[model samples]
Target chain A: MNKPPTIVIIDYGCGNLFSIQRALTELDVPSTISRNPDEIAKADKIILPGVGAFGKGMENIRRFGLLEVLGAFVASGRPVLGICLGMQLLMRASHEFGYHEGLHWIPGQVTKLRPGQPGEETVKIPHVGWSPVNFNSNNDGLFHRLQNGTYMYFLHSYFVTTENPMCGIATTTYGNNVFCSACCKENIVGVQFHPEISGPSGLRLLQNFVFLK
Target chain B: MKNRRIIARLDIKGPNLVKGIQFDGNRALGLSEDFAYLYYQEGADEMIFYDTVASLYRRNNLIEFVTAVSKHIFVPLTVSGGIRNVEDVQKILRAGADKVAINTAAIANTSLIKISAEAFGSQCVLAGIEAKRKENGDYEAWVDYGREPTGVNVVEWAQRVVDFGAGEILLTSIDREGTGNGYDLELTARVAQSVPVPVIASGGAGRKSHVLDVIHEGRADAVAVASMFHYYYAKPLQRMYSSTNADGLRLGAQIDEGNLEFLNARYGGILERRFDPISVKGLKSFLAGSGIQCRNM
Candidate 1:
């Protein structure tokens, strides 16, 4: 068996890093949390995890000078998984609290997950809880090692709507709306759910990400 | 469409799991970590680690328990009690709690909700509202585990909490809690209807139908229970289930009188057979039987 390459979790100062790190450790895949450009760029795979606002997340990434290395790293065709806000930050823009620019790595616009009339604040926003993720194609990359209809926990109000519709490879429903839950554009992938906190299915998803060539 | 959530709300007193009727009597159930794992395994949608008396004691002590459980349990965990400021929220979240349920402190300092929500996203802050019905047929919000009354109408407070940036409302009725009288469906409906965010109907749930009442009629996004989860088959207040079959869970593989001690030493107490004593698994299957969508099944 070949030794697993060094997996780096990009610590941009905000994320559920501990849980993710603990999950990786349980999978017997020792990983490192790094903000250094060189360490991040040199890793075998990268996991961009964030837990807060898209603008603030982007601000931190730019502040840490990780914005460029991240794009360059994914351009190298190595696997990169963005979780929740991390995935949102991969989009071109977000409508949260005015307008904010994303990494533009994935061609999409981040918007609130709602289904009522426009400006009706009555609809539930942050769609919290566990829901199933249905893939557009057969059990392939990202859905690797997992069966269909497996449930993963989600904790966010906003979702990504890709301009490049082909970018969305997976989908989940909230209310009457079906939006992009996971997007895979070549080596770049983003999931608007927390795999680290999604239990065994999530751990399996992380494991699949680890072995993804 | 999203499925309704079934949350196992475990009360903690200094890192130990305890259960009480209407926030009064404190009886030990088991170690926090053990029951957390057990409940999560038996099909709880989520878990709440509420420090039952964090105010009287002055600080939160379940950080280590949250850390231990989060490492193993993949579902979201909400920590309540003694969280007064953003730093406390940060502390709990850093310790691996996914959300912080603020009650007393949120009443003391309303800005804590906005600040914590801004810092850690609104999704991480749950407005823990303990409400008691008043003489005027209106409900007032209480804090410090129903010790202090805010004199705020439950419906009004629920809306205010959301506007103040609470991602969800954990509405617990003091009147029905631990009584097995079933949740205060009226109270739950009022608050849930008033709030834009998700509302978790809690307290007064003795049977599975009570959960249905709150979720279907009250429009609560989730249901939280304590006593329903503490006992099994109307057992006595001392027997604790440790195995998947609800066998007495061992403390250290210790056997006493040919039976494994179910987490003995002031731990593991069952509630009286007030209502139907069913396991989390039973609750899930019951809900599923009624065509309700639940995880792990």
Candidate 2:
């Protein structure tokens, strides 16, 4: 028999930890919400859930000294997931609330979703509510059990832009074109949408993340 | 030309459906599942379930209820009550609620609105305000199930909610509730004018005309009435439901006249549909833009 995955949700003082913990618990995954580095180090997988400005979130993680621990965990080839602002933190830097440095797990910058050029209806910033997210890669565990064009809820102002297209696993559209919704590179996965609040679709996504081998 | 919306609001007490007067007069009515299906078949565009007892209880029952309802219903559903922080909102939405409404939390933290809105999106984050007319004729914000006053001016607080990223405002009036005297149009208008996002008028709605009046005159994007529809004393119900044959009413009214025409035209089948102003307006706009000639009646 295989043991369930031990998932540690990083409680960086700016996340919806309990709810994410509860969702993981419902999926039968063993998860804990903690700010301590030891608990995160001992886990099979880690989740960074955040819900605030980029600078403040990174500041809290740095203040708590969980940054090195999380970086070490990611380097260990184990699964690490960053949600919402947590995903943004994986980028090189963010322009939100003034410029600030991120974890730089992914090679990119976090920029706002602005309107299109002349004669174009620019998609508004903070694309909210249930929008359809389509997978770009078919060989990943994130999109394994899910069908194409699945609608997931998203609420964010800024998005990550990576030089490497291989990092993007799924993309969703708002006004005109598509933007990266989920990105994966090796054991590290980042999602801009809250799989916890995305209903059954979100639950299935989380379940996929938990059981990813 | 935006689409009209059909919304169903489920008032819950624990696991069962509850109906009462205002915020204090709640009584368990029946299973929420049954009513949910009923409203879905009736052509509700979207559904919202408020856990009136959520703040009172230690745990939120809205998640389980939303899960059950999501299995059977395909429309968008929003759940609210007792959400104190971002974590609470996350749990409800992950459990199958498309949106989470926060009332008391917004009054307490104020920042919770921005956090949830940024993390979840403004559309999924709603700010529900329970207001009562003060002695000076101005509506004041209330908290703790409408028993405590926040001392914030209702209009000012509304602007703040929007600024904080509340995609929509759920405004409920305590004074005119259950009285069916019609909505506090003045208050609703003030709130609608104050916020840039959509405002859902709650509290006092006695007749179908009141719903129309609030949406058209009060400038509310949506209206929520619990007791009027639950108790069955809701007048002009049929007029709003199947009055498609009336001439003076707008083309939007005809589309909502009955579920048959609406379903045959909209849903591709015959289903009993309750007409919501949002959905009706959308249908009208669609027809008008498409050049489909149809009279108001």
C-alpha DockQ of every model: 0.63, 0.06
The RMSD of every model to the true structure, in order and in angstroms, is: 4.0, 10.3
Worst 10 residues of 1 chain B by lDDT: B251-260
Which residue runs of candidate 1 sit more than 4 Å off their true CA positions? A117-123, B233-247, B250-272
Model 1 residue A13 CA deviation in Å: 3.0
Give TM-scores of chain A for all candidates.
0.94, 0.94
What tens-digit string does per-residue lDDT give for candidate 2 at A123-175? Answer: 43455445667788794588776778775656677788776998888887766
A50: Cα error in model 1, Å = 1.7
Q: On a 0 to 100 scale, what is the lDDT of residue A133 in model 1?
A: 88
lDDT by residue for model 1 (A81-161), tens: 999998998899999999999898888899887656665423366787878888876638789877777788888878999
Q: What is the TM-score of chain B alone in each candidate?
A: 0.88, 0.76
Give the number of the best model, judged by lDDT: 1
Expressed as tens digits, the lDDT of each residue in B147-171 for candidate 1 is: 8888788888788888889999998
Candidate 2 Cα errors over 4 Å, as ranges: A115-125, B1-8, B13-15, B20-27, B31-126, B130-157, B163-168, B172-297
Determine which window of 10 residues in candidate 2 chain B has minimal summed lDDT.
B267-276
